[model samples]
Target: MDPLSEVLSLLKLRSYVSGGFDAAGDWAIRFGPHEGIKFHAVVAGSCWLSVEGELPVQVNAGECFLLSRGLPFSIASDLSLDPIHVSQVLPPNPSGRILSYNGGGDYLSIGGHFTLAEGQADLLLQVLPPLLHVRDQLGSATLRWCVERMRQELAEGQPGDFIVAQQLATIVLVQALRFYLSGRKAENPGWLFALADKRLCAAMAAMHATPGERWTLQTLARVAGMSRTAFAVTFKGTVGLSPIAYLTHWRMMQAADHLVSSRCSLAEIGSAVGYDSEKSFGAAFKRVMRCSPREYGRRQGGKGGPMLRSGPTSSSTHTGG
Candidate 1:
């Protein structure tokens, strides 16, 4: 359970400042992400969520949508877009009302931090479609429960407001995952389908849980209950990446993240990823990330090394503390 515990712990540390906005006041509310996933809920009435580089995704009262991956996005109201720093529309459409705010109840939003965790949690989270919107008709019951839970947290906001919000976010996430898992059939290709097979899911969990394990084609093959040759071909075809590549990529990604967020030394990082020597680890890191561990750490600190000078001082995927 330690694996599941790690995933839950990171999520527990996350919260999307729980609050509501009312349209009766004709007020304009805005915020900037300066580092995690944000979950916005439309509690009552409708408001416009205008994200740059994409059209405004409308939300009726009671609907919930995550800003996908928390990229630099914006939400605004009608008759007033000011005080809100909106990204300028390229090619200047200045013509369409991206989103329409209607009369009704209050507008509610929940913002929370999100990150990659270990094993099942990490792999499951990776399959999510960017910018998930749960319609009332398609995902109503579970969505309603999530909305009510968040609403309660926002209203009571007691001694455990943070903890309660974290729980609600998880519920919402699980609900979304449930919907995503059942929504499509064999007709549509999806990342989550990889988890549909019990064998694949179990094998994946083992590889992720112990990247440093002396895992090989045969080991993973046995886990999947398939012959080495068959598993190798199927794994690649279904996952779009060879099993070895997938393991290496996930290990390096974890190593890179640790380099940025943890004080673990290079030797520790190498050991964590199954490398016996710092040279081997550094070589793998460079081969994959195009930079050494130190330089990668610098980029993760929010200052770019060479290519990405203008964005993310902390190499973070989300904004804010």
Candidate 2:
């Protein structure tokens, strides 16, 4: 599988559709820093997303964006408008119903949050930008389909709503990643850029496809069809890490996921990711995840359990796509 596919599969993200929102005239909503990733899709009308440290981006109908790293931001009709906290305007509604906020103009959108694997969000975040903007997804059938599915799931609240929504959310992120990578130049630096390089892509695919392989620089270089010296230089330059370092990161990410989602023994988990022993795996995991394997499981809400979903489950007001 491709690196992006591998990363998405390992994340085991749970998505919750937080209904929809409608606003008219002068209005802005501040979404506070959330624990999980948040996203917004403009179904009708337009808005400006003002994320700190980046210029406000104008999003029209059919456009969507993903905000990770829990950076607080505001969506407004205009950048000059004073914003109201989403909590203040939307308020809590015990009754799950469509929400509307009247200002003057008509705007419609749907939003939700994605809860990633416990103690392993940073591994995925490190490869993606803080903001992933998909301008005019109307032209992309895949994106449109995913959004429509999510909207339907949120609106109908059928028996399989949660499962369908979660699946759609994964598709949305995958499509968004494809959109971002396709738009970026080959020379760009980052994991995404690295995936674009044919030689590096070969090596990355190898690493992701078989994390337990006893991979060495020489073997990886052979996989990339490059000499050891050139592959090492290009891999580090393109991926921002040595080949071994990247492999370790990938292994630990897989280990973290298994630790939280499975009932396997620590030694089995370690061996699955190429570690020879449980002690070695624990050391590497601590170095990367900042916690011991047992501690990490506890922090993740205990072993062999579902990851906790963060953010608002049900809100008073929501607007549909």
Candidate 3:
């Protein structure tokens, strides 16, 4: 079974939203999740998205804030804003279609809400200021072109419009991730994918391929073709975690899944993950996931029925791109 199959980055989406203002002014949005990432893009209008405890971020039309690590933040017409709903205020002098959010049915099918009732445990919350907008920015040639095309497909409401809209939204989201990641300073990066370095994606590929191998910073630096110091700095800047820290986290996440899903014993699991002893394995697992191997196993077993791991269970599968 592919261990990486069930792993999805915290959050990712592309959306075409209506500019949240009536007047020729800007608006903003703030977002905070107890956990997970928040991402946003502006099709039209202008505003700033400020992370409360972090540095302030500014976004314009055709731009996005890929808050890779979820933080409590807000957006406003100017800085110092709170998340106000699109319906919060109407356009000051309405001559055009001034709606709080983008209009029409296709928006829902495209930007999501397509499977809200499908028991999707990973659904994003609706109450979010993580995404913001402005008035004049929406008039840009680039944004206008994208919005018009999306609107047309959604407006047509044809048989294949649903699929077409989702694909377009996904494209928009990818554009936002690129813009957000490109302009960040060293103080920030992803919270988990620390090995998600511009240069270190290759290093991660190495580790993922051989998680059972003994890894050292020096060796990793060689794989990255940099001095240890330069590799460390670049790796942390892009991934937001140290190399050793990232490896430990990835191992623990995988170990948790394996212990619960596979027939492997604690000793086997520990050895498979580069741990030489059960004690060392248990210690690492606790440090990362806050639970011991025995505790994790006990929790997975039913109170009274044939235990699942007593024999093999049906295998699960997923598709990857």
Pick by lDDT: which candidate is best?
A: 2
- Using all chains and alpha carbons, the TM-scores for the candidates as numbered come to 0.66, 0.83, 0.55
* Number of backbone collisions per candidate: 13, 10, 16
Off by over 4 Å in 2: 94-97, 103-105, 137-139, 152-162, 186-188, 294-321
Candidate 1 C-alpha RMSD relative to the actual structure: 10.1
Per-residue alpha-carbon lDDT of candidate 2 for residues 1-321, written as tens digits (9 for 90 to 100): 788778767876677777678788888888888877888877779999998777899988777899987898999988888988888876656233346788433887778888877556676676667787898743467777777777677678688786777778777777777777777664435667777678899999998898888888999999999999999999988878899888888888887787677767777777788876667777888888788877776677544574423222221121110
- Tell how far residue 163 is off in model 2, in angstroms: 4.0
lDDT of 3 at 31: 38
| lDDT (10s digit) by residue, model 1, range 46-73 | 6666554667677777677765444666
Candidate 1 Cα outliers beyond 4 Å, as residue runs: 1-13, 24-35, 45-58, 69-130, 137-143, 185-193, 257-265, 297-321
Worst 10 residues of 3 by lDDT: 112-121
For model 1, what is the C-alpha lDDT against the true structure? 0.59
Query: lDDT per residue, candidate 3, 1-321, as tens digits?
Result: 121222322122233332222223444433335343344445455556666566656655554454433456666666644466433444666322323443321111112211111111132332123432222232244434554455566556567654565555555543433333333433424532332254586677666666667888888889878899998887777666788777776677566656655777676777777787777778998887677877776765442212224322222221110
What lDDT score belongs to each candidate, Candidate 1 first? Answer: 0.59, 0.77, 0.50
The CA lDDT at 162 in model 2 is: 64
